[model samples]
Target chain A: MNLLVDAFAWIFDPAHQAGANGIPTRLVQHLGISLLVLLVASAIAIPVGYLIGHTGKGRTLAVSLTGGFRSLPTLGLLIILALWLGVGLEAPLIALIVLAVPPILAGAYSGFEAVDRRTIDAARAVGMTEWQIVSKVEVPLGLPLLIGGLRSGTLQIIATATLADYVGAGGLGHFIFVGQKSNDYPQMLAGSLLVIALALLSEGIFALLQKLVVPRGVVANQSTDVRRPSSRRVAVVGFPTEERK
Target chain B: MNWVIENLPLIGQRTLEHLALSIPPIVLSFVLSVPIGWLANRYRWSRGVLLTVLGLLYAIPSLPLFVVLPIILGTGLRDSVNVIVALTLYGIALMVRTTADALGSVSSDVTQSATAMGFSPWTRFWRVDLPLAGPVLLAGIRVVAVSTVSLVTVGAVLGIKSLGLLFTDGLQRNIVAEVATGMVATIALALVIDFALVLAGRMLMPWTRTVSPKRERRALPVDEAVTA
Candidate 1:
C-alpha cells in the first residue's frame, strides 16, 4: 500500500524530474526509438505487403514468416544481438525492427486484402490502369487496416522499447533495471506505471485514427453490418469485433 | 557447439522448467477465457468494455509486469508463481476476444436447430457451439501455447529459472553458444507445442479436415502474437 504511494511520489518528485536519466528523458528515448523502428519497418514491410496483397501471392510465406518471427522470444533476441553487435542502440534497434515488422507486414497486406474484389473489378471495368487502381482504390480502402496494423505495431514497439536498457540502450526500462539492481521498488513501480500510461495513450490515439481513417461512405455502408463489426478487419490481435462498437 | 553438447542435460532441464512454467497459464487462461468470452458474446453491451479492458491488460509489457507484480501480489521477487500468474493474465487477455470471436463464428441456424431438438443452452454449448467453435478456439489456444512457451524465458531476468536463464547467464559469461542454445530450445519448444496443438485439433475436430484450405487460412492471423 505504502509502496504505491512512494511510486507516485517518485514520479512526481521534482528532483527526479530533471536529469540525464530523468523521466522526461527516458520517455523521449522510448518514443524516439519506437518511432524510428516503426518508420523503418513500415518502409520495408508496406511495399512487400502491398505487392503480396496486390498480386495475391506469397501470403503463405508471409504468414509462416510472421509465425516464425513471433515465436523468437524478444528478450533472448535482444541479449544475443547485444552480444554480437556490442552494447549500443544498434543492436536494440535491429531487434526492435524485427519485432515491429511482422504486424506491419500483416497489416499492410491484409488491409489490401480486405478491400472488396467487386470494387476492384468495377475500377478495372471503368478503364482505370493498374497503378491508378492501386493508388486510388486499394490504398484508400485499405488505409484503416493499414493504420490498424500501425497501431498494433506502435503499441508493441512502445511496450518492447522498455527493454532497450537490457542491452544498454537507455529508455524508461532503465529505471526498472536500476531499481531492480538496488531494491528500489518505488522507482521500479514508477517506471512501470509510466510505460502502462504511455501504452494506453497510444492505444487510444490509434483507436481514434482507425475511426477517422474509415472512408465516410464505407462507414455509412458498414452501419447495416454493425452487428458483425469485427468480421471485416482481420483479428490481428484478437481485438474483439465488438471493440469498435 | 561443444558447449551445447556438454550442457545437454542443463538445456533439457531448462526446457522442462520452461514447459512447467508455461503450460499452466495456457490451460488456465483458456478455461477462464471461454466463460468471459461467452459473456462478452451473449451481451452486446459488455463486449466492447470486456475486450477493451483485456486489450489494455495485454499492452503492459511483460518485464515490468514481472517486477511490478510482486509489489501488487506481495509475493517474493523471484517467485515462479508470479510468472505463472502474470502469463495467465496475458493469456486470458489475448484469448478472451479470440474466444468471443470463435463463439461468434458459430452459425446461428445450427444453434437454433439444436434448440429445436430440445437441447438446453448448457448442453447446446458443450455439444454444438463449443464443437462448432472448436477450430478457431484451437487456433487461439495454439497461439497461446507458442507465445506462452516463448514468453516464459522472460522470467529468467528476475532470476527465475527457464531457458531464458541461458541468455542472461551466457551474456554475463560471454558465451554465445549458451544463448544460441536458449533461442533454439525456446523456439523448438514452441514449435513442438504448436504442432501438438494442431494434431490435437485434428483429432478433436475431425470435421475441420474437410474445411477448405482457404477458410482455414482465414481462421489464423499474425495479430495474436503481435499483441503478445
Candidate 2:
C-alpha cells in the first residue's frame, strides 16, 4: 500500500517531470516505438498470413517457422542488431518487429484456417470468385482472430520494447535502467506499472474493438473466444488450440 | 565457424548457465501449475479470474519484472534466484491456462464413464483425465520451454550471465560472432526442445500420430476435387 502510494508520488512529482528524463516524455517514446513496431508487423504479417490461409498451401510450415521467431531472445536480438546496425532506432525497432510478426502471422493464417471448410465450399457453390470469398467471407469471419493476433503482437511489443533502453533507443526503459543502476526501486516499480498499464489498456481496447468489428452471426458465442483465446497466443508460438466442433 | 570452434569452452559454459537458468523454472512452474490448473478447471467460478490473473502477470514486461522481482523477493539483482523466479512466473502464467485447457479438453463422456465405474475423483483425474490431457499439456509445455529459453537471456541485463551475456558482451565489443553464436545457441535450444516435445507427444499419444478416419474422409474428397 505504502509502496503504491510512493510509486504514484514518484510519477506525479514535479521535480521528476522537468528533465530529459520526464515520465511524459519517456511514455511518448515508449508508445511511439511500440506503435511503430505494431504497424510494421501488422502490415507484413496480416497480408502474408491471409494469402497463406487462403491458398492453404505452406500455411502450416509458415506458421510453425514464424513461431520460431518467438523464442529468439529480444534482448539478445536487440543487442545484436544494435551492434550491427549501430545504436539508433534500427536495432530495437527491427528486433521488436521481428518479435511482433509471429503471433500476428499465426493469428491471421490460423484464423483463415479456423474458418469452416464448409463455408468456403458453400461460397464456391454460390459462384463467388476466389478473391471475393476471401475478402467477403474469409476475412470478415477471420477478423476476430486477426485482431486477436494484432492484439497479441501489440501486447508483446509493448511489453518487450522496454528493452529499447538496453540499446539507448530511449523509451520508458530509461527510467528503469537509470533507476536500477541507482537502486531506485520506487522509480523502477513506477515504470513497470506504466508498462503494465499500457499493455492492459491495449488489450482491453483491442478486445472491445474485436467485439465491435466481428459480426454477431460469425462467432457463435463469447465462449469461442475462451476456447481459442487467440489460438494459444500466450502459450506456444504456433500453438494452435484444437478447434472444438 | 572458426570463432565458434576456438571459443567452444566459453560457449559451452554459457550454454550450461543458460540451461541451468531456464530448466529449473520450467520444471518448477510445471510442478506448481498442475494443481492450480486442476482447481481452475474444476471450479468454473475461478477459471476466468485465474487465467486472467496469470495473463496479466505475463503481460508485465520482463525488464520491469526482472528489476522488480528482487525487491519483491528481497534478493539482489545479481542473484540467479531473480532470473529463476521471473521465468517461473512467466512459465506458470502460460502453463496454467494451457494446463486447465488440457484438462478441460478431456471429453466429459470419458470422465462420466470413469465415474460410472465408481472410480474416485482422484483416480479419474490421474487415470483418465491427466493421461487424456497429456498431449495438449505437452503442447503447452513446448511453448513454455521455448519462451523460457528466450526469456532467460533477458537475465543478461541484470548480470545473471547466461549465453545472453555473449550477446551483451558481443554488442559492447562489436563482436558479431559472439552475438550471433549466442542467438543461434538460444534458438537451437528452443527448437530442439520443441521438436523433442513433438516427438515425445507423438510417442505418448500414438493415436494422434496416425491418420484418423474422419481426417481421411476430408482428405480423399479434397484430393479428388483437386485432381479432377
Which predicted model would earn the best DockQ?
2
Report the lDDT tens digits of candidate 1 across residue range A1-245.
89989999999999889889899999899988988999999999999999998999999999898778878998889999999999999999999999999999999999899999999999999999999999999998888778878887887788678887877899899998899899998998899888888888998888888787778876666532122333343445666764443
Q: Which tens-of-lDDT digit does each residue in B45-157 have in candidate 1?
A: 78888988898888878888887898779998899999999999999998888888888878666786799999999999999988988888898888888888988888887
How far is A133's C-alpha from truth in model 2 (Å)?
1.8
Q: How does candidate 1 fare on TM-score?
A: 0.91
Candidate 2, B74-120: lDDT as tens digits = 88768899889988998999989988888887767677679999999
Candidate 2 CA-lDDT value: 0.84
C-alpha TM-scores of all predictions? 0.91, 0.87
Clashing pairs in 1: A236-B223
A16-52, model 2: which lDDT tens digit per residue? Answer: 7866788888889999998888888889999999989
Whole-structure CA lDDT of model 1: 0.87
Question: Chain A of candidate 1: what's the TM-score?
Answer: 0.89
lDDT of 1 at A134: 94
